[model samples]
Target: MSKKKEALLAQYAGHITEKFSETPNMAFLDKVVTGLGPAIYNRDAALVSGSDESELETVKANFLIKKLGLEDGPHLMHAIKEVIREYGASERNKYRAVVYYILARRFNKEGIYK
Candidate 1:
């Protein structure tokens, strides 16, 4: 990994550990970050807006359904809401990689990264 990527990964790992009190699987997290591509370097793109319904819909449609091949249903939205809740409603900087990591694991889609 590049130095910048490493730094960002470390920063994200810290957020996961400190905020969620979970020790992340480094390999999985690395793949999640790498999969995110250049979007991670963009400040606005890197963050998930829990308050935006459209943004959440995009995550469900694009990431969950399209990327992970999950079927469309109410449960998907419920899962997204659950993740946002877990991330904390009041939390402003909900990193996209962390959110994706949690969702990927929630649905047992880690193999997609492998």
Candidate 2:
């Protein structure tokens, strides 16, 4: 993984630990991050390291929709691209942070992360 992704993951781990302060489920958080982290890392790495941009976006869109359980549409596509640009344009490492944030928020709302 890239240094940037490593840093973001560390930061998120701290936040997760703090968020679960009463119970302090670092084990669960660790499991979640470790289990899901590599895929996010590799996808972003491919986006940055690979040559085909359009193909990557298509693949990324598919992955995001499937992983996020979101509907496939132009709006979701625009939102994905917008989030990427909003967080940090061309910064693959930061992209995972946003993706994780989205996923975490969804899980939290579903009472899975809490």
Highest lDDT model number: 1
* Candidate 1 segments exceeding 4 Å error: none
lDDT accuracy of residue 107 in candidate 2: 37
Residue-wise lDDT of candidate 1 within 50-111, one digit each (tens)?
98999999999999999999999999999999888988967899999999998998899999
lDDT of all predictions, in order shown? 0.93, 0.47
Question: Model 1 Cα RMSD, Å?
Answer: 1.0
RMSD of every candidate to native, in Å, equals 1.0, 7.3
Candidate 1 lDDT score at position 11: 87
lDDT of 2 by residue, 2-52 (tens): 686567556656543443223324444444455455565565542322234
Model 2 stretches astray by more than 4 angstroms:
1-8, 12-32, 37-62, 90-92, 95-97, 103-114
Candidate 1: residue pairs that collide = none
What is the lDDT, from 0 to 100, of the residue 75 in candidate 2? 66
lDDT (0-100) at residue 97 of candidate 2? 36
